[model samples]
Target: MAIAKTSPSIKYSFPPFVPDGARLIILGTLPGEESLRLQQYYAHPRNHFWPLIAALAGKRMPSSFAGRVALLQGNRWALWDVLEGAERIGSSDAAIRNPTPNAFGKFFSKYPDITSVAFNGQKAHDLFRRYVIKPGIVANDRLTAIDLPSSSPLHTIPFEEKLAVWHDRLAPYLPPKPQNRRAK
Candidate 1:
């Protein structure tokens, strides 16, 4: 896919933060308007991203931005988007254009500890194939990329179903929480 030319009316920026010491990097397309306005990742109220993450971790929903960041960091999860910047009319992934993709290689190089990478949805997976992954370029010992279900209300699947899929895909990476351990 060819990159679209940047538009004068469009303004975009990368997520303001990322988790340190992340073992897995999770990428998505550009943040929705709510996220941008809030200056936080997945801030849209209807978005299932945060709730799904909480379900997977078996924790109560985080009530604040700092709590959400802590939850991700505590789980060794890193968050960022595949597009460094893009022109778009709204939150729709299909509306993205002139995408200046993020330098994922740089992150992988710097955080050699990241062993697995997963995309938040089809848009990210497709973009990765078009821009990065399909190039046959590997960083820090050949990271594997997995396509995960979109944790968005736009997806028709029920919340429980989404949780099940995510739980299975993420199981290998998440260690058993203390609550799940049995007394020996």
Candidate 2:
């Protein structure tokens, strides 16, 4: 289905942390309260998204929102959400209701170079399946969905365990760091 332009009454913005010539697109369901408030992705202090990414990228942790945005963009990674708008009571993913999911097909059509799609958690994946994947907008071969552990503190998994799983799944997608390169 085509994504219609959001109505002016809708109070939302697509905070895409995208990079040019990105081969991968990482999707989430929607911005949590902190993200919306800060006008940035993964704004919650307890969210492991940035820290894990920094570790995987082998860079010092980004100190500012612009720094984080630059890191993702520099790596040729794109970030956006599946939901354009939703009735959310608080930041909990479980609290989302009547979601107006974004038009992913349109986005993909605009950027055919995106070779892989990653979901931040199961909610985004499920939304994609119900709205886009099952509808045949996205062919299974064209994209694969990897459900990473939720970065939310609510998940209660230890940080190390989370890092292990995320590191394993995300390592292949990360652009190689200079330190990892060897002289020929």
lDDT tens digits by residue: candidate 1, 1-184 = 9999754346465652557667888888888888889888899998889898888777899899888777787788888888888888878888887887777777667887887888898998888778776665454248777778998779879888888888888888786667676789
Candidate 1 residue runs with Cα over 4 Å from true position: 1-8, 16-20, 135-141, 179-184
Colliding pairs, model 2: none
Instruction: Count clashes in each candidate, considering only residues at least 3 apart in sequence or on different chains.
Output: 0, 0
lDDT tens readout by residue for model 2, 86-163: 876678778777777687777888888987887887888888888777788778788867778777777788878878
The parts of candidate 2 lying over 4 Å away from their true place are: 1-13, 179-184
lDDT of 1: 0.79
lDDT, each prediction? 0.79, 0.78
